[model samples]
Target: MSPISILTFVASLLFADLVNADRVLGAYIFQRHGDRSAKAWPPTKLTSLGYSQEYRTGSFFHDRYISDNSSYQIDGISTDIVNLAQVTASAPQDDVIDNSGEGFLQGLYPPVGSIATETLRNGSTIQSPLNGYQLIPMSDVRSGSGSEDNTWLQSASSCSKAKFSSNNYFNSKSYHDLLSTTRGLYQSLEPLVNQTFSPSELSYKNAYTIWDLLHVALIHNSTASFPSSVTLTDTVMQELFVLGNEHEFNLAYNISDPIRAVAGMNLAGEVLTALNETITSGGKSKLNIQFGAYASFLSYFGLSGLSSANANFTGIPGYASSMAWELVTNDEGTGMPPHVGH
Candidate 1:
């Protein structure tokens, strides 16, 4: 394996070795939504490529975890029954996440042969409808709905305490220390950002939106050139992208205070709750929970754990990238708690 991939594998093993599970039993997946238009702009919708990307991700999961010959497959549960009672799917209420979940589930339990043949009381064989496509229940968890917490999926925006903690990081010596090398890059980009958004709307404290605009424009609209004369060369834009990503990282999880990871803590708690429910209920009530959020949150989640294992764990996750924390056990039902791995 490449160095980075090897590091990630070693990290997973370390996490899995803790508490010593007999084998993997269940899992929880937190994924960054697939390709979409810039959120800073309007009509932020998923692209056709986004749908295809997530579909492939789901298919990959099927081969690894749900296939009949896979070690992770639930005993006595056929792949055809995955959509019936063996799997439950979900995402955030945002349309981007919702669509991504839909595409992913379709791949996990594709339409070709989703239904099972059954004999009725009158001895008549009944074939399922919808062209053998089973409809899996997908619950979009709305923030602030009853007891649902916003920190779970919207941690970058919703965690009040984490926000407070992150603010302190900006004032820390480490931030200033890094700024010495980055200040020049920011200076060049500041004028462009100011021109794009009102002074009140954008600032050094939160210029991620500006960086995002530049990024999207470079990727999606570069052939036509930018509407404004705020020219940014490819090298400059790439540097700014890295800096902006770092800003987002520190905002989500600062090293000085563990409270900076409060958002991740909240989401991790929810993941564990879902996994434990799946295990405690003998997989009867377990959910195939799928969380969709931005790459910033995914980096933060990793910084809270994986960074300790791999210092180079700093790249912003790719579009539709996912992390799964599998719950493994053995014949004796002895296992460790779920840990972030594949």
Candidate 2:
């Protein structure tokens, strides 16, 4: 068996440990923030549904990779009272994503309801808050040249080469063809977004923004008042989603230059380096979870040749989506699993 294995979830795919003979070492997880308030509206926050989505994702992973009964459990990971040294998590300080991380951790290490109290050395006893909720520190990944946060989304990082390559797409004959052909489709959306968008903003250029506004309404405000007035038909909404997917994927990657998807390049580098550390340290560092947006997922898929794997890999990932890498080996006694694997 190969020393390295991957478990990925796109959209609503369920979590299941693959049946294999390889021994589990450790894993690295990259997760997208769960559902949140629409970005079209400012000050976006994680909603109840978003929180639940993240919590459920974390719980499923814990069951498969951390629970005692799971055959794939990491060799020496802490199931409770999290050993901060073995597990590490990081997320940008954005409110929605930051809050999403906490929701995931809640399920990863649930409250110790009965073991909440501890006697102090001074004959005083104190109980942890929220019934001994495990408090794990998720480091803040700030925006900068070398920081990991910037690679999670194109907008978070400023890469001149990437910007130039991306802009060239807008000038292509294909882009122009689509823009002219899609006018009618966009115009129909005026009634729904009339107040929020100008006539010019309804074009293909703003496909994602327009789609997101309506999508959130379809999920949360179907009965309530949304931007202008007209309710979107299911067919129209589906088209918008398709258009948005194409638009976003194009911006994140292209055959012209790898610079177009620098975010993916950076992520690949980080994943490789971290995995190497796990092997070198003999699996002392167990699990690493990082949370980010969908942009990185799109680019990573393209760069890693996963875009050809399935329909899901080629499109925008749904909320709470995740991809993981496991360091595995069939060898019982090992200094390091083979440097290369079958």
Candidate 3:
């Protein structure tokens, strides 16, 4: 072959490589919060058990992405000896358990009984207190004649006197403080509150708060009834997708919202199916399937809703969790076991 012909062939090979690179499938996945104990009145943090669960979840991903030799290869070397890099972001808003500032333990337990009341008929002192702090006539309690010596009357009079005479407590200042705190809390939720978008934006920030709230409630609420005011504001819907690729690609795509979820799942499924089909048609070696998902999401499917008819509508054999399963046969037309790595 001439020099120019050889150079042209080398350039053609590089072009083919570029085209194949662009065709490779990528995936991203987001998961719900990790298992938590019942919310504490003061807002419970993750417990030791919860931390252990998280650690195991992280390890599972690491093994799947970093240690899988047949499935995940990094820099032309097996990832079996390296750990996958993981990053986490947290919710900015504080989880408030009890915002009603009565007392810490007051509402934790239910009230035993109801308070008794008095009825006034002819404006006479009815149901007067026998000793103290009993049901007393409003007139006697407010009267300045000092004939009423009950503890309730004494307490009320003391409170009235203190309000009038003291400079320590100002009602206006207290009201202002309450308003300021409320405004601050509202400001903290500005991201969710201030989302203004056209009909075309496909970003997660546009749909996350609403989707997350609905999804969480749907899975956790006992009633399992849809919220009355649910309106699908956007075209995006949440889905889970499986992908077989390097850990970096998965991290880069990082599914964060319903739109991304559905898109990633569809794209990954299509690409994987196509790749498997190509191997079968061309008589190539079957590629191993190495997949990773958001840790909490795996738990949800394997242990929670995805296993039930109430949660899943269309069920098929070999389909597990939100992932679609398929087998690729070799030239001998022999079925091969799926090599799932992580």
For all predicted structures, in order, the TM-scores are 0.73, 0.87, 0.22
Candidate 1 lDDT at 141 equals 53
Which candidate leads the pack in TM-score?
Answer: 2
Q: After superposition, how far is residue 227 of candidate 1 from its true place, in Å?
A: 7.6
Worst 10 residues of 1 by lDDT: 1-10
**Rank list by lDDT:** 2, 1, 3
Comparison by lDDT, 1 against 2, better one: 2
The best candidate by lDDT is 2
Could you give candidate 3's per-residue lDDT for residues 1-342 as a string of tens digits? 000100000011112343332221111222122333322111333334433444454344333333434232111222321111211111212221111101111111112222222456866443323221221111111111220111111121223432242222223464345334434333333343234323232222122223333333334454324333443222222321111111112211222222212323433454355444433433232222222122222222323234243322111111011222222222122222132121
* Model 3 steric clash pairs: 64-342
lDDT of each: 0.59, 0.74, 0.25
For candidate 2, the per-residue lDDT at 307 reads 76
TM-score of 1: 0.73
Q: List the residue pairs that clash in candidate 1.
A: 23-328, 23-329, 24-328, 25-327, 25-328
Estimate the TM-score for candidate 2. 0.87
How well does model 2 score by local distance difference test?
0.74
Question: What is candidate 2's lDDT per residue for 94-196, written digit by digit as tens?
Answer: 7778888899988887888657788989999899988898888988764322222222245665687887777777998877887899999998888778877
Off by over 4 Å in 3: 1-26, 68-342
User: Which prediction has more favorable lDDT, 1 or 3?
Assistant: 1
Model 2 worst lDDT run, 10 consecutive residues: 9-18
lDDT comparing candidate 3 with the true structure: 0.25
